[model samples]
Target: MTVTSARFGYDDLRGLITRVVDVKHAPEDSTLDVLWTLYDRVLDLSPERLDSPDRDRFYLSKGHNPGSFYAVLAAKGYLPDAWLDEAFTAGSRLGGHPDRTLVPGAEISSGSLGHGLPLAVGTALGLRAQGLLKPRIYVLLGDAELDEGTNHEAMAYAGATGLDNITVVVVDNGSASHGWPGGIASRFTAQGWSASEVDGRDHDAIEAGLRGHHGTGPHAVVAFATSSI
Candidate 1:
């Protein structure tokens, strides 16, 4: 169930992260800031409106280490703060990878790389087909995940189709085995996407980069961090 009380602040996030024990994998430390910025400022989603057709959708494609994602969800009151204590345990719904069926606010079950963006593309198309154009589709991806061929296909398709309702945030920790030549933003721009690059740690820059898209086509924001998670 969703909580209706006042949401926890940034200060409470560290404590929430510490609640999870025996976590085999943890999201990039940089992801904490990005997740917080989205939930706290950018996203038009809340625990109370999970079922709303007009609510925006956020997919976490970089779900190998979901500790930060869980913390953000807890802070936003989508999941009880206490549930975090049992994360990854046998009895807990929270796991190493987020499950949409188990988590209150998760829009998709994800862990395998390269699937989230494709799924978001399909979702945007589906929503448009249903005349539900108010909801935007947002997906978070890791820099390394871009190496997947499937993601390239999805990116090309979304761009060619003028999928303006879609926004992709790529946390670039510089972990991609084969890095882009002109940088990540160029990859998207070449595919007809509106793109921007920003410091991953700067909340204002991140927000600006995300909002910079003006409904031309799909937008991609590459958040560069100093180190890999």
Candidate 2:
């Protein structure tokens, strides 16, 4: 039974992330652990959702934080936490970047900043080609990732193609990773996309934004998160 992080408010989520981040030097490691915790505690979480033609797809574009991703998977019952100890020790399945073959729930081998969303768009298009339209593709991007031209190209393409099934999530913690002027949402909107700006730590806000969302084109969700872990 997965516990909906929903029950926990933004403050609570922040606390959890803070704790995880403080516990490790590598924020990616902390994030992986948190993802694991969510998996373990959250109900009905599974990568199997991706297998069904009608199910949703998610791509973590901020693949540098493999530790967080891995942890989340382990918590969700996809990967074993013990793997963390072993992989970090040797040339193990777990590496600095995500290896989809080793991690079950990870949708793509994400490390290249701008590739995840494009890959997600492709997946959405592929599913659309197969006549599965309702299920959408969600991509999580880091603030720093915006600097990559590939991401902008992907966003522009998504807008031009009118990919209503594609959603772009940007996690911004006020970091200088990307030259996000004013705000990322505004840039997305300028690119002809419907954007939603929210507190990344707020589960309720996140749920609302997600549920209330109707992607006419590629929707960009800007999450102003302070700490990703």
Candidate 3:
């Protein structure tokens, strides 16, 4: 049920993803393909206008591993290539996790799990309040993060408020201590949000899941990996 995304052209994107990662900081590998598809295909934000109020916002809620997030940012020209060189080194801006103040395109500093989705809802609401309805809000979260009560509150509010401009992509790698009973997508759909699941490793499927919903509510795309979660 993969829906085709609206047309958007990209060049040398895989090459750019490669340029941002190295052996020492290779934890980003799992998210490389998905992140690239978002930055290179779906999201409408850019590095030049990091301060633009009209720019789409992406909040990385799963900050435990930001290698892929950093890679996507660098590939999209949000940070200099040299930022990779000193990544994780002493006093480096690019540390174990992402900091919005340090990274040009990073909208918020993330680390305390389960905080991103709630923030994304606020961002979308704030945008709507400002009469800037065109800019969409996106938040990427780990499947494990959904176990938190904060995410539940956020999704419920978004669904009730018809926050259709927000998109939540849950990277399900089966790492959650308490696995979801039915499915992750069901949780969102139950709360009145449009929901879908897709192959996490396939770029086409991921993009489609991200774009499938055409309703007047928020969306949830659960990218399922071959692994447990």
Candidate No. with top lDDT: 1
Pick by lDDT: 1 or 2, better one:
1
- For residues 5-44, could you state the per-residue lDDT of candidate 2 as single tens digits? 2223323333333333345543443233223323333223
Query: Candidate 3, which ten residues in sequence have the lowest lDDT sum?
Result: 1-10
Question: What is the Cα-based lDDT of residue 171 in candidate 2?
Answer: 71
Cα lDDT of model 3 by residue, 47-103, tens digit: 666778998888888887676676567666777656666777777778767888777
**Candidates by lDDT, descending order:** 1, 3, 2
Global lDDT scores for all candidate models = 0.86, 0.63, 0.78
Residue pairs with backbone atoms closer than 3 Å in model 3 (clashes): 174-229
Error of 2 at 175 (Å): 2.6
Span of 10 residues, lowest total lDDT, candidate 2 = 1-10
| Per-residue accuracy of model 1 over 98-165 as CA lDDT, tens digit each | 99999889999998899999999999999999999888888999999999899999999999989999
Model 1 CA lDDT for position 29: 67
Models sorted by TM-score, best on top:
1, 3, 2
**On a 0 to 1 TM-score scale, where does candidate 3 land against the true structure?**
0.87
